[model samples]
Target: MSDEPLVRTVRPGVRVGVDVGSARVGVAASDPTATFAHPVRTLARDEQHGTDLTELVTLVEELAAVEVVVGLPLLLSGQEGEAARIARDYAVALAARVGTVTVRLVDERLTTVDAHRRLRDSGVPGRGQRKVVDQAAAVLILQTALDTEARSGKPPGEPVTTGGRRKKERRR
Candidate 1:
């Protein structure tokens, strides 16, 4: 483990953001210039993980994504929790499948809450929210990442190394 933070250049290109869940995965994509993130779709997870991964690859190819950003659900204290571990595992699995495209994990603290709020503000009821909340959360996560990179001039979040260990775990 190293003390230095791994930082990457924030480049302009199509980027995809993923919010992984046990039941569903939400996907969002940015434009070529990487200005905005829009909700793409939510895919139901099949019993075979390979099938879901293949769909992700196909989506990446169709969108011409240069980067794949996955939401890392860190605790409020900025510590890795159980959900974080699950997210990291999913990200590692995703990274292995996406050849060449950069895979990143960004902290997603209140994205889901914000998504719920947004849906409520838009007058979407609870039942309606269930169908699209994940997608909305994905949008929030990707948009935050894009804005962070734009403001800081550094890539948002930590890059997911190909070694199957997440940034925090690598420190251990």
Candidate 2:
């Protein structure tokens, strides 16, 4: 594992973002400079439990990611639901499997909606878009994390912003 900081510093290597779902897993990756996030690939969920996670870990390793960000789907009321719990559990397991890489969760409210809108705006056919929705959502999640880090002066892996817009930093 690289000695790079996980949360704030834009280290010189790839950082991975994941949108985990029951049916599919969307993956995105950012450049080391943290300037852009590009959709990588989506993996179909394995019928056998735990198999998909093992695959996910391999994918992360292949990307040579310094940090892993998993999307946590919180309800609009900001409460954890079954999906959130599952995502968190997956994150814990993924962290253990990856070893040495920082695995973090970022609130992923509205990411799917945003991704759908983006695809529609881009003229992607609805039927074709379904295949890649998870990948697009993963990109959105990663982009949001990067934007939050930039605005809040927090490191990339740190949880700085809440569900809403970033709060104004108080003047010293």
How many backbone clashes does every candidate have? 0, 5
- Which regions of candidate 1 deviate over 4 angstroms? 1-10, 164-172
TM-score of 1: 0.87
**Candidate 2 residues 75-157, lDDT tens each?**
99999999988877777777767766677789999898899999999999999888989999999988888777765666544
**lDDT: worst 10-residue window of model 1:** 163-172
Deviation (Å) of 172 in candidate 1: 32
lDDT per residue (tens digit) for residues 92-121 in model 1: 888887777778999999898999999999
Candidate 2 C-alpha error for residue 53, in Å: 1.7
Score every model by TM-score: 0.87, 0.81
**Model 2 / residue 81 / CA error / Å:** 0.8
